[model samples]
Target: MTLLIENASLIMSVQDNGRFGFMRFGLPESGPMDWRAFNHANRLVDNPPDNACLEIGFTDASLRVEKDALLAVCGAGYQISLKGRKMPMWMSFWAKKGDLLDFEKTPGGNWAYLAASGGICSQVWMGSRSVYAIGGLGRLLQRGDRILIGKSIHRSRWDAGWFIPQENRPAYDIDISAGVVPGPQYEWFTDEAQTAFWQQKFNVTSRSDRMGYRLRGENLTHRTGADLLSQGMVMGEIQVPPDGQPIVMMPDHPTTGGYTSIGTVCRADLSLIAQAQPGISEISFIEINLNDARDKLTKTIEDIDKIEKPQEDVWTQL
Candidate 1:
């Protein structure tokens, strides 16, 4: 089966769980910005949780199904329509050949995920199908791009009408609190800088992207200075440059950096930052110990595992 891109305003690409274990080789894991939504979209269509899906960015796009297919969408700030009829997100739907799927940008979040029943057919690079444009693995989807669809292994299940509960959906409202653990160079910052980092609310600048989010807030001065030998970096590491502004490393961030880091946003809260709409989202940091971070992440995974079983009366009211 094939899916054709009819139109796109910005960039959309295929992203799976992520490219892992290859970061040591200088490859950053480029996956869905909102992982929970991505996984939920896949599960709604009865696809594996980590199956490849369309990662739609902060703009408009549309797709046309060349063959009958089951699909789902999940995330904030976007609306999906089939053949000009509006469809609810976080729920499974069926599309026949020639059906056009339209995605309209809304005002809450920045990214969304579209998953087909069998996942997108794409070449894997470094053990993942995620598109890392900077690394030249795959380019963004464009008009007339024909994306192959994998063969579905499961039978028809859309009649079950699965949906993500409203309470479980991620909120993209203002003044979001993101959990973090101290980075390796946490102590390098002055006490006042550290205090301000936690106390102040930082606005996500328009400069943010898959590489990192440059925040605008009170400058965080470092006692040990700004320049450091380039060291290994990871997703969520909050690195402060000489300008004293913090840059939260993301999935496509470089393998190494020369700035001092104050803390690393925990895995559980990375989605919160990822969904933060640039130029409008305000974020605050909450420090958590390593153990707590791990425990929270474990619980999140457990909750995701339970999504396959539909709960009565839990459908999100559109």
Candidate 2:
């Protein structure tokens, strides 16, 4: 049998490829906020893309294993340990019955991913296990909640030698060298204000969440300040309401919004924006042309594919 989670400390949920095509009906794409990092974590465990994972939030969550299993923990800084011995993040490790796997909140990043050999087997909603926190539909793991495990991973190994170690961790800087193309509302801004947007720096406000990041910077302005009819929104679309401050949308952003969007953050750099932890410091936006943005997006995807978490594939030898 697969290992069970006897104690799920703080916030935890099963997230997979994310629910899509429903935004037409006003449902947000409520998948892993940092999907690139999450997918990489799964690959490290040899699990294919779309395998569900425990989306550990800002709070450090804890759990007790009920059986032996292989697991990989990835994404932002977090103190992970098994039965008091230190465990590495972004790499696979073993856990046995009664072994306590604990995760502490990261000082820099906003989320962490915990992936098992297969994945978390929770009741699916709309064909996904992603917890839409506002909908109250998917699994919202709580204390004393015994999570059901997937099938037992009979045979699997880890390539700890080849994979990169957690010590020399990759850096996630908020350099906005790649800004989004100004959208349908770009004409509304004066030339001077548009210049300031790409020139000035903005600090991530304390009110950030999975929904959107409220930025505090030079007052981003528009000529009309008039209310507009609600329109479609995607992650990274910077929506400016009446206050002139921009709210960068995230995975769970609303399907439609009435606010005017001056520009959007490119998909390639969305994670950088998502990983901006509260009180971390100032983040500046730099504008990049459309062609450059597309080229970068293609390269990022290929780079992630090359960095597979070798633990998952080891099972093939069994």
Candidate 3:
């Protein structure tokens, strides 16, 4: 199977689960902006949970099928059509050879994922297919590009038993109520600032993307008035620049930073930030213990797993 990039504003190279165990080498995890949707798209196509999928950003994207294929889309609801017929978002469907797939501007979230049966064929680097935009490694897609398709084992049909229920689908929201934990520089902030951080709401600025999200909120000042050396940073780390606004780092974040980080966003709520559309309202934070954070993430994985496996009856029908 193959996919021809007929027209698209921007499409990134293969972005799978992510590159892991290399943060020590000063590398950041460059994966799906909305991992929940990436995994969901793969599940819909009967591919492995971590299979590679197309991570599309806010803009027009179009493609043509070179062979029969099963496909699905998830995340920000964008304009999608197959052969002049409107393609439903968050549902698995089939496309025949010569079918044209088109995607317009994103109406909801910041990114979208397009997963085919098996997965998109691309060269893997560092144990992942995720494009590292800054690393000069993986990259955005281009027009007139013919992409290879992996061999699909489940090419038969879809059964209702394997369908994802409406309630199970992920939704887009603005009030990002994410779990926050005190950072190394948390002591530098006064109790008042800390309280304000959680109580006050901040608006997401237009200067946001896969790299980091900048917020326009109350000026958060440090208590100690001290400067610290540049240190390692992680995804979801909220750093306060000299201007006093907190910036939440995302998937394609840098390895190090010089700003003071007052807190870090919990893994469970990272997706909430990832799905935030520009002009969305500010989000509040609640502190949680490390063990609680782990449990919450574990439970989320279990819920996603439920969506991956095909129902017994559904498989039999296929």
- Model 1 lDDT tens row, 1-318: 998999974868999999889878898887887788888888878887778999888898999999988888888778889899898888887777899999999978888899998899899987899999988998888899988889986454334367776666665576689999987998999999989999999998989888898999999999969999999998899999999999989888999999898999998888889888877888999999999999988877666555443654443221
Better of 1 and 2 by TM-score: 1
Q: Model 3 TM-score?
A: 0.90
**Could you tell me the TM-score of candidate 2?**
0.88
Clash counts per candidate, in order, are 0, 4, 2
**Candidate 1 similarity to native, TM-score:** 0.93
Name the regions of candidate 2 deviating beyond 4 angstroms: 1-11, 152-170, 174-178, 308-318
Best by TM-score: 1
lDDT of 2 by residue, 1-318 (tens): 344455554456778888877889888878887777787677766677888888877776788878777777777757788888876676667667788888877576777888877677877888788888787766577777666667745353343312334432335664434367777687777787788888887878889887899988888777877368988989889898888888999888888999898888888778777777666656677777789889977876665555434555553332
Model 2 Cα shift for residue 144 (angstroms): 1.5
Question: Which pairs of residues clash in candidate 3, taking residues 3 or more apart in a chain or in different chains?
Answer: 9-60, 11-141
lDDT of 1 at 152: 85
- Residue 180 of model 3: what lDDT? 83
